[model samples]
Target: MSGKTRIALVTGGSGGIGRVVATRLAADGMTVVVHYAGNPAPAEEVAKEIAGAGGSAVTLQADVTEPERVRELFDAVEQQFGGVDVVVNTAGVMILKPVTELDVDDLDRMLRLNVRGAFLVSQEAARRLRAGGALINFATTVRKLALPTYAGYAASKAAVEALTPILAKELRGRDVTVNAVAPGPTATPFFFKGKPQEVIDQMSKAAPLERLGEPADAAEAVAFLAGPARWVNGQTVFVNGGVI
Candidate 1:
């Protein structure tokens, strides 16, 4: 709020989609804080790359599931950069299985990171971000596809989609926008893990684009929502390649 440079804090910045979002925002002249949970190496590399490219960036580690840590995350941004302008919550866990074979532990993990972690990061963003700030949360297009194996994971993301509008409304007149990005079949480590190549190919063909989404594809949407899309709020923009 005190500096001319806009500040953006991207959670899960060590990962595929998150890292791209952080990098893109920094390229747009926003000071980006790359947040990681357990992994620091990737976050560090991303930050280094940004600085090398003449963009401003800093890497921070925080467990978004912890309220104190989430609060401190915002505090660090405010303390160092004067204030935060955009908060992108890309931290989440995905566990896929049909309802009949789903493990409760997997479901719990999904809710903990995908739902609870997102809420915590978004909550802090709402409290600390200056006017014109934007809060972007990650959702999944699988929810609309109604994919059978994603029962547990989709349910968790469903909660995230459901929260966007309410949070946006609560911030009414504050000039803060709250929204979600639902990416489908992205070519990220998080998506490739545990899946066979054949399944991946099939899903890719499911999209009219006939390919898995690249991290940049999703980041482009985030960049727009994070900045000039001020009139767009309380909505979930699907980043799938015409799948849903």
Candidate 2:
């Protein structure tokens, strides 16, 4: 990299993992665009923290599943920051249910937000990124474990995984790297809300690391992929702490 201020667009930047990724990237000196789907408060909070820490950041609201909105999101980033150097797709929805109980609408929603959203964001990033930039997509360890009630969500992540290789090839000779990060049972609000403490404890003990993953832990991996890791491309770095 040329040591210029790099720009990063993190989708779902208002949420737990996304917030950590955005903050960490900013701390690493990358100008961050915190993209949120519905709520802007959390995104703005993150942006303010970055600024307070002497880093540059901005909060933007956009539904990644919408092509026009995604285009606008990137356009605004380009207008403000010159161009994007890193793109992370953390926008996802989980509607857990057995395959038999999965509603068509729910399935469509998962596919739209998880699969199509990643594709659209990656496409735009590929089109706009400066050479040596990186694109990181969020997948899940559920694809490996094949857990019950997560078929739809897992399938969506699997689609993301499948796209990484082709995207890497498509971006060949451009010096931009594409990759995915799959986190397992992280200690995010989404994983803890409404869940029994006993169940959470048991789940934590199942991982080889003997605790739930932290958002910062996953964000660390994301940071690596975004900068100074150009050699690691077209791969899924599983951040489940050795969980099978």
lDDT of each: 0.91, 0.92
Number of clashing pairs per prediction, in order: 0, 0
What is the overall TM-score of model 2 with all chains considered together?
A: 0.97
TM-scores for the candidates: 0.97, 0.97
lDDT of 2 at 189: 84
- Candidate 2 lDDT over 142-171, as tens digits, reads 899887788999999999999997899998
In model 2, the Cα lDDT at residue 122 comes to 88
Task: Report the number of backbone clashes for model 1.
Answer: 0
What stretches of model 1 exceed 4 Å from their correct place?
1-3
How much lDDT does candidate 2 score? 0.92
The superposed Cα distance between candidate 1 and the true structure at residue 230, in angstroms, equals 1.0
Cα lDDT tens digits, model 1, 1-244, are 3348899999998778998999999998898999999868999999999999999999888888889998888888888988899999898888878899988988898899999999998888888889888999999999999987898989899999999999999998899999999999899988999999899889989988899999999999999998889899999999999997
